[model samples]
Target: MRFPHVRRGKAEEPPGIVGVARVDLRTKVLVRRLEPGDIAVIDHADLDRVSADELIACRVAAVVNAAKSVTGRYPNLGPRLLLEAGIPLIDDVGAEVLSRIADGATVRLDKDVLYNARDQVLAKGVLMTEETLDAAMEDANAGVPTQIDSFAANTLEFLRRERDMLTHGIDVPRLTTRMLDKHVLVVVRGYRYREDLRALRPYIREYRPVLLAVDAGADALLEAGYRPHVIIGDMDSVSDEALQVGAELVVHAYPDGRAPGMGRLRGLGLDGVSLPAPGTSEDVALLVADACGASLIAVVGTHWTLEEFLDKGRPGMASTFLTHLRVGSKLVNARGVHQLYQSRISGWALAALMIAAAVTIGVAIAYSPTGPILGNWISATWHTFAYWFTGLFK
Candidate 1:
């Protein structure tokens, strides 16, 4: 997709750029309710690629951000992605615009200026373009060293706080799911999650592994026709239908036992056990699988690389790093498994082979010397059964 180079202070009008505005402080939550042709108004700063992808999937006509899409902290790829997808992006519109504009109100965009029905200007923001994005990316790249230093410091602090849990595996929540001596598949809604799951279809069918989903990954599993045996996460992104699918719910809470998600469960009239730990939900899911003594754990779409961690804007990747260390031997990346494993013979092929074998056996028997003896035996048995049947009816 190609985007026009937008010059700053240019007053050129974009053709037919009008739609209902959908406002939300939380981009992720807003994305769930977003519909195609609607203008997304969000307060997200330095929006990540994943969120951008979700918004793109929703097919929003445009995005208006209250905060800077690229703050020069690091090269966040979200704004660039949206622009490249041919979606209009207006940045630094200020948070006050969210309060002034009501949700589902029709708004028109004339270049960078947003107006209500009366043509009154509500907000003005800078239109992002290829030149500006490239410049911002260069600045962001120059700032990576400082970000890395901050990341290291945060990781060290996380390691210090989570040492006991990592080393001893103490305080891991007990689960009723029998993971011991059985394969456990942990699905996370991360990069290429749907593609990874599609590739692992053979593995899923052959092993019949215990399906464990983290947040929206539960919906992914359901879409793939597999019911999650256990659902682990903060319960924010997952749908209510997924929660009511009868899977065991495990809520990830703070170390101090503050579970913000518990209220949602209570509101849903659902029961869940709290797992207090300091880490991402995916990390907690891995820990749960290891703690439950899974023979092998296959992970799908979990972030691994430093860039991926940074893309997620998660400063506590030290916990994920430590969790991997604890579950070292058993954990296997599903992406690797998809590449290496051989495809098993499908059920239809096996059935066809069995039918072919049966036909061959029948042809051989018909031409064999013992064919006459076999026919005589069959005739005698039928006659005897017929006589018995006639006597019973009489």
Candidate 2:
């Protein structure tokens, strides 16, 4: 089949890029199995930074996205990161290409066209360039005011819907961990979570707070050498291995009582309970702690800033804002706590401090009238030790 080249301008062609196609409807799931030198076939719209970071870490040869990489909704950093990493990005290739191309099929990306081993053009897409991406980012920045207005509207709508649940309390599921009058650490797999977890090591060791992981945060906890006391989320991002680790699993269901993730758990023969809620899983986790009467709830890796909420690409963050307000006095962001709390002194520093104190004491003794008495005592002790040594020899 003959395919027309949709070249935009007279620009230099990108270098040879060829690899096996790894196709998945969900970018998050696809990233788990992606390897270096493989072309990722994804259907992600306005690809977020976290997904892009995962793709970059996989070292993919190129990305063939079936949807628009940037819709000018917000200045998402995903496409920019891929381009900065020297990875070719082909956007808006259409959903038909996903069917035309088979998984594990060796394909060559020549300019903006993709060809199979038989030299048949499978699909064509716009190859993103630095100039084009920069222009799109500028446009996205200009649209920030509109996005913020929309976000505020959504937040108000959420407040109206979930006011009672947030203010009163959620009917929390029974769990093995008792949070009553205790400190609870709720970890979410969001911004700088690993670094925050590293910093919280001393606190975790000292308090032994209930380790509550939200979705993939379970994996994060396990990696940090702590088992989760409760695992709550939609159960999509978390691994089956983490599910089987014996933590109580609570699936976040829609307000209308629909639980989609329960099928996956039943398929794996794992037991879990469903908790109907309107907000994100992290929000539900905080509510669960609050309902369980936790004295203090420390949060790690949860979104706080407006930019972070935008990065999430979801309007439901209005629920997050309300969740914070409801959990008020009890909720403390772990990021801030980590920054303020001073860690225990190291052994080397402690030893050096002790040495300094001993030297100061010795100097004070030498200058005071007690110097002669100390000198005589030291001499007598030395002679006694010397006599003991001589007697042993004899």
Candidate 3:
């Protein structure tokens, strides 16, 4: 409630179904107790990290959400868990609200509907509404697929910018020799990118791209079966293990000539190159790859949405924009390049699944009073055959 956010009142904006409330931000409620019918806005993506277990344990009449749940880019049955426990599930108030409201903002519901806190109410309208609930369900259904496409497109744009930034031409920074024989994997600290990388690890080892970690991405790369070729950042999130991994270090210095990572590298007895680039760790990593003439820079676990940056509580979006613009042409996301990279299930895996299904069906049918065991077995076996036949990848 002590946090500052713009305030608007219900009188300022009408209370009916003015618009869809989609909650994507999930954060801890600083208030004492959420009343039975009071509508609350949750907006942090890592609710598990940001929210207290007690807040989640609260049984409310209804709840509105704002962030993607842990179950991928979609809203899982998490909010519904409370609802099924007797609380009603309401809308997912999307990024639009975060762009509008702030911490400790007071809002009015109806006659007895004044929801107040020490914080300024950033929301101008009523929280719980039938229209808002419907919108949350609709968004929950659509959020996952939309997120996947957005991730893919942002990755593509990042690669292209990287290629361009490399050729930007700086003659003063000749402290290192540049070569392009190896491929590059540009890493960023994105949510579940490590899992995504784990799912696709085999392919990464296959390509054997020069692993370039952008701060926290160094740990991610190591976890996903790759040694980093270079660690690039301001020495903030890159771990101690990642620091001395024998990878060449590049300290991204401020334009003011302060190289933060240099001191860390020096203490570790590691040599590092400094690049005076003004942007994010990811951006600096891309620039290093370009300057070194790294061929084919691929990206993983990168931030793709504006809301993502806001979740980090950053004051600006300049670094993200600049990084994308710099590495737009040459980046490809982790596709089915893992063993499953774009490959459909083989007849063997499908046949295995079908057989697994048929055995259970036969067991169930044998116990059915109306079932002809012989006929049921035959039908199930046929389905298994047909499924395998259709599922076979040519």
Candidate 4:
């Protein structure tokens, strides 16, 4: 049920937002290639906050979603985040939108309709605004109990299935990189990771903790000019350059021993250790560090709240819940570590203070009763020194 603008041989195109369309069913994959001012076409339902944050960072002109942005599913915060950022969001456009609008094709979006370069309508959807998103969020909040029930069921099922591993310990792989009694920084490419990592720079420089990166988190570390000591995850999002950085690779796999990352490592002629576990890569990373005798584990970009766990949209989140229970004694958020331990004063601060003191003293002396006399003497001393130095050079 799309409305087409059928004005033929128009002198000027319709007034609307114009940009190249980047279409993908997976929002995460699409965001990587999207440039600022491009229109993002995604099929994400109940769009999570993490995905919305990425889309916002890309500075997209508009978002056209093939699926409903919100389905009263646990009050997801993605649509609201987009609206707050002033990015136009068109919701519930049919899946046909993906096929109708070609990727990398120039398109124009009016209030609710998307038009191709020829000014023909491709798809139409409900435009999401602050008012509509707020109404949806309220209704969605009513559905949280159902989601919580589902979450509880999944958590119970996971606990039943993974009780032994959770109680005893994961069969961690051996590594050349040591963690015994050392502070371990487990970096995940999750919520506000960049800001938290930037804040932790002083702590990172001072402590020099073992950097454990999960998939794309390795790239984040490298971007911040730090080499990861260990990289662990399914081989999907991490780059080839990160793989070749000589970090000890640990391929986390299914408990049944299906290691997808191992094949990728082999293809690159690289060796890796495999640790098959029940939970997420982050969970496995934390547990592995604890088992290896880490003094403390500081995590960056980890999901901590119920909304965050729901945003993750995975049954494996139940395993992460259990993982938290197991590692609660020593586990701490990176922001928490940055807040608790005050970094020592730097030499730069000292130098700046010294310079300020010198300037204040000179100003006070220059305004004193002997100001003119001191100024003349200083000028004469400088002139004499310069002449003496020049004579020696001659």
Candidate 5:
């Protein structure tokens, strides 16, 4: 093994940010391989907040996108996050860049230009900064009305198509892990999931809610020292180790009954039941909890706001919105649970009760026939302890 400080007469690096180039057409799949100081070359257009957050977490030195990072589509939060994180973003570098640059190749990102290890120029594109991001956001803000209209149309279409399921809840598969009358915690690796999970630790410990992990959210639960009762998703992002942790896997399928996840599970010699649904995995998980007769459904790392809905970059968010309405009073955001759900026994009350008990015991000891004997025993014990403590110094 080589140590950094032990190396002698090392050559000076190139003039710009130098790192290995990790390229992929799918941003989400690509993020898993990303390591610190690696340059991420993706073909993502109008990158969403979740994908951007993943890239930021990977600590990629720079991001080179084949498509526009913000195509003025509802003010995408990805580019802004990357900029804020001080990760250099080269926008709209074109698809040729993906083909030209091989994965694992050492590349240098100098301003807007990308160069190979041999210092050969590969591609050049606009380097996004605060000014460019702001301008693009301004244009995106102007286009929000059009996006909102489109979103509304999609929502109505979804509601019309899934009217039966939304009205009466989706047909949930029978499982050994019962959720009836119990608080079910549905976890998704979305907005503020880590922070929200940290906040919900007390609630989780107190209630011992049924932990239901959605895809990669299973890994999150495992990281937080939790084992999910059931795992639901398309089975694309979750780790194999998480799948083998004795959790029941429910693969979310398309409305037409095409379950892609089953193929993956079968390939791994694992068994899972399929639940054909219309919306995203997050939506399906919520519906499952509601349909399973859960008393309360607490969600962690799930979207709640209009901005979060837009940030998802999916038309199926309409289904999520409808799912919340269907779940009604049963659905509660885990973030707010701490404020809403208060324990019956408070620390102050318990402390006061203990103090009262002590006072009553003291009074009884003073009035009782054996009170003098008890008092003498207590006083002698205290005197012995005090003497032993002081004698240590001598």
Candidate 6:
């Protein structure tokens, strides 16, 4: 359904507006007028930071992007899933687009296109989709639309077939390490997963997962008040403090048998072992947990697509090549910890609330503040508190 464009300054929304869904940013920034109920659609500076799978699982119906997603500048998963799910999308809604939108402004997608399950363009024009992306790129690359679609369809089909074979109860060759049976928490380096991690604190603390870091993830996990049992990967992104934190370090080596990260491990006075497989640090991590017989492996900020791989600008993914081989059914992408676990007020929150309430009540009785402005501010604060509390249930 097309949302009627709300001309700036209009308080009344036309029927076209289905309600504002929050915009997330990545390549560009959009600051639109919005209200509390609006979706916080966003794009991160790093595409991998945006969790498309979780977003879909939560079932947002529309998105406005501030980046050139289907423009060949980045991966297609974000736009691809939106289109497939029939979510309306507008691309390149950068800073300019944001400035025009106000909090609670009904966001209208004047141009949204869609594609069907068969990869056929059901609708086209203003919205972003792989078809639009392919056509624009194909035109420049001198390839026909049909040919590109054929290749992509075949590729998607093959991926599905392979996933079925690999994940559907079969055993294959895998890397071995003994930490597999531990409650493993895999960390990815310097991403926007901080909020996700913070929200996951209850689970992490309650379960006490074996904290495993892949380079920078070691530093991140440490900062979050967690200790690393093992730090895996190239050892480049990890901090010296983290290296010194007493976690065992293992260097990942290339297939040619060169362990480049070994030197870094040595410099940190840590002994290392080489896992010469092909993939990202995350890929080898899965192998490590699986090989080690991890009872359950949970991944935070893990990459799941070619777009993410390409966005990293790596040549190939050899380490990840056999990862599905090792941890086929043992993996869990714990992106939405907020959804998986309920936050109980517990005795702590309740006790803290009582103390705060007593202070607020005592101050109000003593001061008897009378200014309308101050009263309004207090009301807004309460309203905002109520909004966030509702999100916990949502």
In candidate 6, what are the lDDT values of residues 205-290, reduced to their tens digit?
Answer: 79888888888788668778888888888775567788888777777787566888988777766776776654466776776676
Worst 10 residues of 6 by lDDT: 25-34
* C-alpha lDDT of all candidate models, in order: 0.86, 0.88, 0.56, 0.89, 0.89, 0.58
Rank by lDDT (best first): 5, 4, 2, 1, 6, 3
Residue pairs in collision within model 5: none
Q: TM-score: which candidate is best?
A: 4
TM-scores for every predicted model = 0.81, 0.79, 0.46, 0.85, 0.83, 0.48
Per-prediction CA RMSD (Å): 7.1, 7.4, 15.9, 5.0, 6.8, 17.0
List, residue by residue over 1-394, the lDDT tens digit for candidate 1.
Answer: 1113346966444444788889999887798789998999999888888789888989999999989999888998898889889998999999899999999888887689888866678899999999989998999999889988988898888888778888777466667789998999999877667778988888788999999999988988998888999999999989899999999999999878999889999999999999888898988999888888889999987887777777777687767877887898998888665566656998899999999998997787789999888878878999999999999989
- lDDT by residue (64-111, candidate 4, tens digit) is 999999988878989988998999999999999999988999999999
For model 2, residues 308-378, the per-residue Cα lDDT tens digits are: 78888889988888889889899888776556676589889999999999999889889989898998998
Q: Would you give me the overall lDDT of model 3?
A: 0.56
lDDT of 2: 0.88
lDDT of 5: 0.89
Candidate 6 lDDT score relative to the true structure: 0.58
Clash pairs, model 1 backbone: none
lDDT of 5 by residue, 272-370 (tens): 999998888988998999888899999998888887888777798988888888887898887665456667998999999999999999999999999
**Clash number by candidate, in order:** 0, 0, 44, 0, 0, 40
Greater-lDDT candidate between 1 and 2? 2
Q: Which candidate, 4 or 6, would have the higher lDDT against the true structure?
A: 4
Q: Between 2 and 3, whose lDDT is larger?
A: 2
The regions of model 1 sitting more than 4 angstroms off are 1-14, 336-394
Report the candidate with higher TM-score, 1 versus 4.
4
Q: Write the per-residue lDDT of candidate 3 for residues 345-365, one digit (tens) a residue.
A: 888999999999999987887
Candidate 4 regions exceeding 4 Å error are 1-10, 336-352, 360-394
